[model samples]
Target: MNITKNKFILLFLCLILLLIASFFLALSYGNAQIPLDSIADIVINHLVYGIKSNDENGALYDIIWLLRMPRIILAICVGAGLSVCGVVMQAIVKNPLADPYILGISSGASLGATAAVLLGIGSTLGENFIGISAFMGALGISFLVLFIANLGGPANSVKLLLAGMALSAICSAFSSFIVYFANNMEGIQTITYWLMGSLAGANWPLLSKLVPLILICIFLLWSQAKILNLMLLGDDTAITLGYNLQIYRQSYLLITSLMIGTIVYASGVLGFVGLLIPHLVRMLIGTDHKYLIPVSALIGASFLIVCDLCCRIILPRAELPIGLLISLIGAPTFIYMMIRKTYSFGSK
Candidate 1:
């Protein structure tokens, strides 16, 4: 037992180091390509002595602190948040294939963002009206799914899945209808880019609000590790062990919705991070939630930081949408995992 505990501790330390390395790597590379030593100097100087940049290094300072820093931080938060939510969602439904967006939240968020951009909905809600609208839509659809699932009786995994699918379809149809009739090509283009997801809009103000929320949600979910593990044993088995899982399932779903909604608001819809990271971590460390949650979070954060860096460097002048890149990578990797016969979900 001591050996196992020590192994986990070592693994965590390695992942944390990897995450820190990825963060610095991302900071060093961009369109301008700042040097690592300079990047470290600027960051440390500002953090320690409350110094802004001098006139000599003004451009580099703005590029590092103003643009890349917030974007990279947002990427880490979105990545970690999505991955942790994936862990909880899979446990909630007791399905290996489940992801954070399986419950129609993504579609709902898309619909809301679409309405905000094209139809000028929620224009009165301040500068972040689009994101606010998206959050509202995501949270609303999640509750709607819960309501639909509980129509006949207590909600179960199967019922929740079906309700989510039904609502997802409906939301997609609505979004398409709005897009088709809007007749505004510029708005359509903006919506298209938004749906594909980008970290370009990331700023310190947004990060100030989003980072804390994501970290809190991740911590709360991590604290529920034991309950999450029990969820894998099926509801009846959990009941036999003197724990009712229904309330826990609903609670987890709600928390995951909030986290994912916040992510959508920040980075638009990032696919596959949530779906991919948790499974990848589970394969490495087994299905123990205590180990699974933090490991997956760290790996996911590093994964996105690297991916976001790729997005910046892939094209000479333009950046690729992160959602498209992730999908391209995640789908093929997932297919390969499925074909690998030795790799079973939730197996030690």
Candidate 2:
């Protein structure tokens, strides 16, 4: 057993190294034709030998640092955050299909961002007011869903999902109402683009807003591995074992809302990541959150990096939105999983 576990750790570490290499490659390759040798030289000079970009006005370094690097890091953060949320939600709700966005959080965030952009409701909050509003929207909806679900019962999985769906409808309608009455063409266009989701706006300034929150979410969820394991055993079992999951579940939902809100605000509603990546990792490593969270984080990050790279390369001088790309890839995989007839949707 120890030998098997050691082998598993070694294999997972190897995958992580490969993911890191892929992240670097993503930073190097883009629309411009920068040579790999120069890419390596530039990296080494900047790191091992503290050198600056050769051309003060050149774009190579800008592309590597401002554009590509930030986008890549955002991809990693969004991917990891979503996957962690998925794992935690699944465990807490005792349903494999439960994902962060399934609880109307994304729609609420969208509504908040839309309100900010269209009505200028929070313009006083500064440039990233949309992001701030979106985060609050997500958190508010999460709390509402939890409250409504737990109204008459212990908030089982079915009730939670029902509450989420109902709240999603309400939020979507409000968003549509805002868009319908808003007379700004440019605002409508911006909202449309944001709904599709892109890494085009990635920059250090924007990244700084989210990186700390993402790191803290990662650490907090990682520390809850054992609790997550217990959570999967159902609430009654957890209660019998003297572990009341009500507060834990609510706290986790808040954390998930915060993390996913940052991602949606940064890139705008990237989908399929939480739903797909966590399921894939569970298939590989079992339902133990101790192993599940970290592995899911690394794998989801790598998957998003590759997907973003494909988005960059798939077109000629035009880029596809990463969210659409994930949907395209994930929809087919989801269909295949359903058709295979091998695994139940939510089973131990």
Among these predictions, the greatest lDDT belongs to 1
Q: Please give the range of 10 consecutive residues that has the lowest summed lDDT in model 1.
A: 339-348
Q: Assess candidate 2 and give its lDDT.
A: 0.81
**Tens-digit per-residue lDDT, 152-270, candidate 2:** 87776677778898999999999999999999999989877777788777888877878888989999999998888887777778889999888788788778887887787787888
Give stretches of model 1 more than 4 Å off: 1-3, 341-348
How accurate locally, in lDDT, is each candidate?
A: 0.89, 0.81
Q: Residue by residue across 88-146, what tens digits does model 1's lDDT show?
A: 98888778888988989999999999999999999999888988899899999999999
Please, what's the RMSD in Å of model 2? 2.4
Question: Residue 89 in model 2: shift from native, Å?
Answer: 1.4
- Which residue pairs in model 1 clash with each other? none
**Clash counts for all predictions:** 0, 0
